[model samples]
Target: MAKMTHMKKQENQKSHFNHISHKEALVLTKIQQIKHQKSMDYWKQLVIAQQQSGFSVTEYCRQQDIKYNAFYYWLRKIREEALESLPQLPEKSTTNPQVAVLSATTVTAAVQTQSSSLKLFCGPVSLEVNEQTSNEMLMQTLRCIKEVFGIC
Candidate 1:
């Protein structure tokens, strides 16, 4: 794109920015893209901060001076983008997906029943999830887990 002739560049820039000269449109688009990226980064940081702060969304929004619904909107938007960025799984796979929700008591019983080098104990319930889980299932499971843990 940088190597193109000025006149030729103008000739090819007729997408949605026809209201302005091609050069101006290109500049405007770049600026808008940068702004959009910054906005995403800002909101993502806020979401991470709230998570680490151990504050509920309502409380976090109040402390941050942002509307409650607006925070949720951005959270949903960012989470969807993250899910989209993950690589797609194969339609048919030979491997089995291992997913389990185990209570502390259950884990203890399992440990007592067998002597193994591997063990997992979560005070609250715990889930063992892997990439083989469907994205929808993973998100839903995670939302449920968050609600259970009250971390979100």
Candidate 2:
């Protein structure tokens, strides 16, 4: 019996596929090159920050000035790749003796901090304020941060 071999044909797929003008291709290639040159650690940091900070993807992207759809697309891509590459995580042990104490302490501290922050005009105001109050102070401050400091 003869062994069978499979051969795949290389079509001129680039021409057949959605083709961009050379100028546009050049621009795209340059952008992709620039993106590739960014450190892997930078992307890892972005993934971790987005995951751990408890922010919605769109909110995080908007706050970080990342393109929204691109962020979500990349996030999904990363997760899928990671799932393929990594071993499954070990199941969490339910019998950890100190978990309850640690969680209770953490929750108590969080509640205390939140209550402190919500105190009416009691916290340290960074700027000296006159009695004249404005309705738009929070909105204005947020705008200033976004525009001037490039913080959102």
- The candidate maximizing lDDT is 1
lDDT for model 2 comes to 0.55
lDDT of 1 by residue, 47-119 (tens): 7678768889899889889999888888787767666654576686558877799999999978775553333
| Model 1: number of backbone collisions | 0
- Candidate with maximal TM-score: 1
Task: List the candidates' TM-scores in order.
Answer: 0.49, 0.31
What tens digits encode model 2's per-residue C-alpha lDDT throughout 2-121?
644443222445454457778887898999877853533355557667766789878898899998887666656554544554344468878875534458889998767655542233
lDDT of each: 0.68, 0.55
Model 1 Cα displacement at 130 (Å)? 7.9
Model 2 CA deviation exceeding 4 Å by range: 1-40, 87-152
